[model samples]
Target: MTPASLVRRSETWNFDIDAYTNPYTPPSPLHRFPPWLSRFLGYRKEQKEDVGNVLGAVWSCVGTVLGLAVIAAVFNNTASIRAHNPPALIASFGASAVLEYNAIRSPLGQPRNALLGHTISAIVGVAITKLFQLSPHFESVKWVAGAVSCGTASALMLLTGTVHPPGGASAVLAATSPEIMAMGWYFVGLVVWGTTLMLGVGLGVNNVQRRFPLYWWTPVDLRELQRRRRRDGRADVENDVQPEKIVDVVREGEEKVSLGGIRIEAWGVEVPEDLVLSKEEAMLLEVLRERLRKRGDDGVLERVPSSRPSTDCTMVLSRSGRSGSDTEVLYSVT
Candidate 1:
């Protein structure tokens, strides 16, 4: 059977309302660093492409050295911080430098994860260690305290959507290391300070050739999503149409297809049946589709004369709520 014949809309498929809603929209003043420093920051939309792996590796090393050095210099030189018996530089930050510099693209390396993950883990670790210290044999069961703190921090990080791997080490260090435990709640402040310094260095180093963060708060444009929802809601009210009824209509119009056992929906992506994609690949396609949709909504994609032959299968995209006369050819399949 032909590919078209294999395609059908799945009525049972449900829309993810949460995907379009972002709690971080109009993010707090603390999270407004990117916009405030827009000139210095680099986002995915601003970059045409990434650097080569060799260049990327070089920058990674530079970032790691600079980030760690800055933190160490500040910690070691400061009279108050240096007074601590074992020094103030947390060991876990070494792991964090790898993520922040080498694996800059990872979600764990993002500002939210880097800041909140380490902070939250530090808090949990300190609290748990204090409780264990109340026991007379606290020294004997210190390893147990370390294990418990790490596991608890991991769970809390996952729940809060801030899963930084180094955070686990921070928690363990707080519970097991005598020096870190002596720092008490002060350990939390050091974690935050070190993370902040590393991120600052990353911003400068990574943006020299590549984007440091794909996004500040989230990958989705929360503000745009909110505007779309409001516009849709107003239209529904004027038409006296229930939201459920509108969803039903949309579902009826959507097409679903399966290619080599992989399900595809009306998200504007198409793949050959023989082709297979990893989860990351599929997510990347979806992000690109979202960007295109946003650009289309802004009426930035207008029709232009095509130099290619007419035999090409061209896909046209028009501004939302506009007619075919305003459509523009987005891509052509040869």
Candidate 2:
């Protein structure tokens, strides 16, 4: 294979962490539940549109109320927490409820973000505030401590890919609120408890009508992607595939060139000529194409019933000579 072809092949089939980390619809486990139970669970491969409708609005309100109420009840009624002068219920969770209930589809609303964001921010906030306390003039510069904690938490959240907006408030509260400061490291436990309770309620309530979390850890199934990559790698090594074979695969169908070397042909679907796609969108499409190609190679496509209507689509990625000229073709045989 030409150096360019080898690079293109590696890019196509190689396992990259970021590729599998991006959000995508994963297969739902709720299908295994009894039909009636599954209906109530509301797990789906596709998310329902979050349009403004009376039923959706009512469900959102219900989820918000239930989540907050559950947390409040636990914190307030618990004898140990009640003994403390100030209640353990933190204000930042009110903002979290907005995302978890109202903006259910948002990445910020997902479990990973909601839990880690609050916990990490709480830790940062408490640690910074404690350090400030050592200065003896903590009262004079407590606001500065709050600002520093919030800023540090923001950076940490971004780096961890768990950027929930409410997390910043949690950090600020930990530094500025006397009750939270008095709790010190114990505040971390309270944040965790509140966040866990909220997520628990979200799972039961939000899933009744619409999906609360689009994904738990990641939207893409990383385990399956890794398995496929390993299998493909083994096959490539065993076959000692030649460059000519790779070229032939790219040239299998009739060739048509397009701008940016992206050739998309669809039979039933209408694609706009002036369509502009972001890099992330292009990468996602590439991942979908890879999945289709893998299914075809495994004879999965051949097993489909022929009586059903289907469409033939092809996508070709070609690079110019200056950019290591090469072509990779993907076909969806349905």
The estimated TM-scores of all candidates read 0.62, 0.61
Ten residues in a row with the worst lDDT in model 2?
A: 264-273
**Which has the greatest TM-score?**
1
> lDDT of all the models against the reference?
0.71, 0.69
lDDT over C-alpha atoms for residue 162 of model 2: 83
Task: Count backbone overlaps in model 2.
Answer: 0
Question: lDDT per residue, candidate 1, 1-334, as tens digits?
Answer: 6665556444455554335437436632334466536534654334476788999999999999999999999998887777765454678999999998888888989998899999999999999999999999999998999999999999888877788999999999999888889989988988898899999999999988787776676767666777887888865644452212111111222233434533233434444334444433444444444454466566665433323233322223223334656553222122
lDDT by residue (267-330, candidate 2, tens digit) is: 1111232443433444444444444556666655432222212222222233332455443422
lDDT of 2 at 123: 96
Candidate 2: which pairs clash? none
Model 1: how far residue 35 lies from native, Å: 11
